[model samples]
Target: MKKKSTNNKKTAICGVLIALAMILSYLESLIPISFAVPGIKLGLANLVTIVALKKLGVKAATIISTGRIVLSGILFSNISVIIYSLAGAAFSIIVMVVVDRMRVFSVTGVSICGAIAHNAGQLLVAAFMLENVNVLYYMSVLGIAGAISGAFIGILASIIIKNITFSI
Candidate 1:
């Protein structure tokens, strides 16, 4: 049936996006760029996430993000990394979905908000794990980094979304 075929196509697309996310994550880890603050990176994998969201909807985006986190964690990092990644991705996606529904901002703005939320989520996890309020001090730095990285990813996603002709 057409419905089953559509589901199969979606599953395939989600798998590809998840693989792309993992590759980006791996490549990003290979680079030594540091912001002198913890938990600051390019967030390159977010491009795939945002693209998946725009193209495939929230369910697909959730699966891709979750798959990326778990696979990358198991392959390249540890349990702690998985926890932080999950928290950050969950917060980022939630904010993005809400902001996206409002239709008040461009993709770039939505991405900026998502990036900030991601940082906040990670900070929350860090604070909880470390049992100290000191982690909150990193917010300002992380916010700036998030804005920059988010804009970069957003621009990339926008371009990719425009050029790609696939539907899910």
Candidate 2:
């Protein structure tokens, strides 16, 4: 039936998006740039997540984000990394979904909030692990980094969403 075919197509697209997110995560790891502060990176994989959220919906985006975290964690990182990634991705995706539904801000604004939530989630985990509330101090720096990286990823996602057409 057409419904089954559509489901199949959506599954295929989700798989491809997951692979792309993993690739982007890998590429981001390869980059030598470090901001001296911990948990600061380009968040390149977020581009796929944002696009998936807009094109497919929150459910697809959730699957893509969670899949990327688990697979990438197993391949390129450790258990701790997985924990942090899960927390960040969960928080980020939740914020993105809420902001997206509100429709007040542009995609870029939603992305920026998602990025900040991601950082905050990670920081919460880190603080708990370290048993030091001082870890919260890092937010000032991470916030700026998140805004910048999120803006870049958001712009990229917007462009892709505008240009590409998918049957699913």
In candidate 2, what are the lDDT values of residues 1-168, reduced to their tens digit?
Answer: 999999999999999999999999889889976777754799999999998898899999999999999998898789999999999999999999999899998889999999999999999999999999997998999988899888988888888999988887
Off by over 4 Å in 2: 36-38
- Please, what is the TM-score per model? 0.96, 0.96
lDDT of each: 0.91, 0.91
Model 1 off-target regions past 4 Å?
none
Give the clash count for each candidate.
0, 0
lDDT by residue (39-120, candidate 1, tens digit) is 4799999998898888888998999999999998998789999999999999999999999999998888889999999999
**Among all windows of ten consecutive residues in candidate 1, which has the lowest summed lDDT?**
31-40
